[model samples]
Target: MNDLVERFEVAFNQIHQHLKEFNGYPKNDNFVELLQRSKLKHSVIRVHFDLLKQYAKLRNALVHERIRDDYYIATPHLEVVESLEHIKQTLDQPPEALEFATHPVIFFKDTSLLTEIMTAFDQQGVSQFPIYSKDNEFLGLLTNDGIVRWIARSVDNNVVNLAGVTAKDVLQDGLNPSIEFLSSHGTVYELEERFERSLEEERKLKAVILTESGKANDAPLGIVTTWDLIKVDRRNEDE
Candidate 1:
């Protein structure tokens, strides 16, 4: 009872502090106002606003009214405490974790000429390229490193038909391009878990490609790289 109340208060205060830090507002702002402002900035909070408001009322009751000496009037139910904890965790997550990617992704067809591919790479400054088949099936990724390796092998073999060679011809066996497909609505936690699992399995994950339905054949909506996750984490820490 008392312990649950204390935990609830702690969680509530944590949420309050997070809101203050995020909004860069004075502590003089009321909790409800801060929450309302947060809803405007975070879609997660907007989705859970009603429940949070109810929890705020409960917290107030637990803290304000006293039924006996040295005891508060209300003891928060276990469910309320759990809800507060969940909200706190959600709020603690960085905004980038929930942000949807919108950057343009450069891709190529496996049959595309190596000359054309290099031209696109030079013009776009893209290092990673998702290669697909003519029917729009995802074949594999064509990274700059892969291109360099293929060029070295071609030079060793005294082959000079670089313009005539296709991306499929230069495809190296056993390079093991690491890519994953995720839905546009997929959560950041899901993205993090996939990356973590790949690391645990000692597999190099290069990109997490987002699609409408998380299918390989679907057109990519966005892409996430290891660097993107690192940047997001760093930004969260700075905030």
Candidate 2:
């Protein structure tokens, strides 16, 4: 009995069951078919689609080519088994978005003064701030890039009246800052997908504001920026 083969089989079975459940357990489709279908709807599956397909073929060979109950013609490498297990765990319990998001999100109202906004940027060390209206409706994201643009414009035109400028006014002057909303329960995978989609569409996303139900009207619960995703990638590499 090869331990690596045993572990691989267990992990593969778990993944198969999960994907089956994800697709409502369609009886006619096989494992690979189920995986192909799931890849369309699940980010985890989509990201690992090719590797998963290879694993499926390996699983089939391992099961069908066994000489006997206690004998085998092929054995899985330890790394292969580990990778399968890791994917299974990720599918079962992915990290929540809020886990890595900046909590107690520092936001500004559209009417907030430049002085107050700058103070926040200095004190909080945050580049992006969610701007809302007086009625608390989300208006736009205020980014340091936008502030720099506003300042550059002011300096270029020799109009340096910063005292009276408001956050909304700065936003209008700044290079349009892009943002999206995610629910409190959103996963890190979803956040990464959002950023990836934005890039594909040629619109860079500045930040993702987490809310109660992923709506603009809901108050922000946390914030996830590109820097946060970089940290997450680094952490994954270290692990």
Candidate 3:
């Protein structure tokens, strides 16, 4: 019982101290207060907040209501201790977003012919391509949805011309090219939060483009779509 209590407290204090140092929260503030405030800045904290809150209450009972120095009134279960330690380890080294993202992203020039894109789609099974200018500046995304829209509008008497159309032309048809950018170092948890936030704002976040600096102008490193978010959730569940 004493060993279990000690392990639980060790994990709890490590997590609390990490949250404080990472967020620069005052040392005088309580664990719950620190968690509530830090959750806004860290997706990991936000995701595990309810459990942490429960742990905080248990910690108070174990510390303040002690029957003796060697015997705690509340002896934490082994499962609870291990759970807290796991969370602490995650906080110490969260999974990077790029680890799950589609990397070496296939991109096309705005002037690239739609025929080429269609061929790549067939051969690579890729649904979207980031269209860039000759200078390598991102113009928009060329998606299957956008291609379908273009095809629908381009059907002139049941004949659509593909030779003259460019990737930029398909982009102009219908698909929302709006994208969010994430830094290469961003965590998987933060990527999930960004997608959720976009849905909450009622905006169609086409995809999250990973850049070296999380800026639109920076060259893209990878991409994360809603489908990728599903993968993240699945992996979390498996873990």
Strongest candidate by TM-score:
3
TM-score of each: 0.62, 0.76, 0.79
Evaluated at residue 108, the lDDT of candidate 2 is 86
Best-fitting candidate, measured by lDDT?
2
In candidate 2, position 206 carries an lDDT of: 83
lDDT (Cα, tens digit) per residue for candidate 2, span 7-113: 99999999999888877789856888998877655567776778889998888889999889888877888888888899899878878889879999888899999
Query: Which regions of candidate 3 deviate over 4 angstroms?
Result: 1-3, 13-57
Please list all clashing residue pairs in model 3, or write none if there are none. Answer: none
User: Which residue pairs overlap in candidate 2's backbone?
Assistant: none
Superposition TM-score, candidate 1 onto the true structure: 0.62
How many residue pairs collide in each prediction?
0, 0, 0
> Model 1 segments beyond 4 Å from truth?
1-102, 157-159, 172-174
- How does each model score on lDDT? 0.75, 0.83, 0.82
Count of backbone collisions within predicted model 2: 0
